[model samples]
Target: MKKKQQEMQQQQELQQQQQQQELQQQQQELRQRDLQQQEKQQRLFFSSSYFISFAAAVRWLPPLAFGEGKNLTAAAAAAAAAAAAAAVAAAAAAAAAAAAGVAACFFLRKEGEG
Candidate 1:
């Protein structure tokens, strides 16, 4: 009789342990789902904000390009173009000076050798 009672007690303990494990598993799943939902909401908010800013920029882009609105981008582009032109001119001048130096050396060397 004692053996039977001991077996029944063991079975009850096993069932309780299984129930506890199942409850823990469910809680973990719920937590994961909550975290996923929060992440999705954050992503949506970030993209929406970016979209709003992009829309605003596009709204002014055409006017700016056509020179009808603020000349911020246009002025910047003009300045950049001017700087690039100056750089090209300087490079050409340096190249010409280098060629002249090489030619003078060749002529002087030929005169000395001859």
Candidate 2:
């Protein structure tokens, strides 16, 4: 009776170990798949060719969100870059207007002065 009990306990331990290994294998597979997805996303976002092609085609892209995370694509990044460029242009225009105003004040004559 003692020997039988010992053998059964050993079998149970072995079965438990096997189950643990199976669970670990499943977890590893899930981790691998997650890594692959992350790699694919990085590749899609950072590919220069993708950006070049997308840039060539977005002349007609209507107004859009183009925010990060929610819209994390090369096209979205290009849109953001374009917006930044536009903002810089607007600032430069404002500065030029201010400079012209200053110049006019210095150069233009009063109503009675020639």
Candidate 3:
């Protein structure tokens, strides 16, 4: 009986070890996927249509703010500055929302897998 118990214990230990190894592998895969996602996001950020739109904005905004040929009045310049600030704030909020959505989806997927 003692020999049988030892055999059973050894089998149990082997199963536990295997389980631990599988868990480690899973964790490593998750980390690799996360890194890949971050790299993809970085690439997307630099190559996105939004960046093109931002470039167009940069090209167009100066003429609008300064006036094409006519001198910009002080009040008009202040108004343009205020509008630009509001546009920046809105863009920032949108970016934050998108980032939060991505994070939420990632965590939810992780939770489901766990």
- Each prediction's whole-model lDDT (CA): 0.66, 0.61, 0.68
Which candidate number has the best TM-score? 1
| Model 1 per-residue lDDT tens digits across residues 36-78 | 7655755665566556545545555666677775667765565
User: What are the TM-scores, per candidate, against the unseen true structure?
Assistant: 0.60, 0.45, 0.48
List, residue by residue over 13-99, the lDDT tens digit for candidate 3.
999999989988897798678767766765565455445545544655576666665434544655565567656755765685678
What's the lDDT for residue 109 in model 1?
78
TM-score of model 3 vs. true structure? 0.48
Report the number of backbone clashes for model 1: 0
Q: What is the lDDT of residue 107 in candidate 3?
A: 77
Question: What ranges in model 3 sit over 4 Å off?
Answer: 49-114
Best first by TM-score, ranked: 1, 3, 2
Q: Which is the winner by lDDT between candidate 1 and candidate 3?
A: 3
Q: Which candidate model has the greater TM-score, 1 or 3?
A: 1
TM-score, model 2 to reference: 0.45
Error of 3 at 21 (Å): 0.2
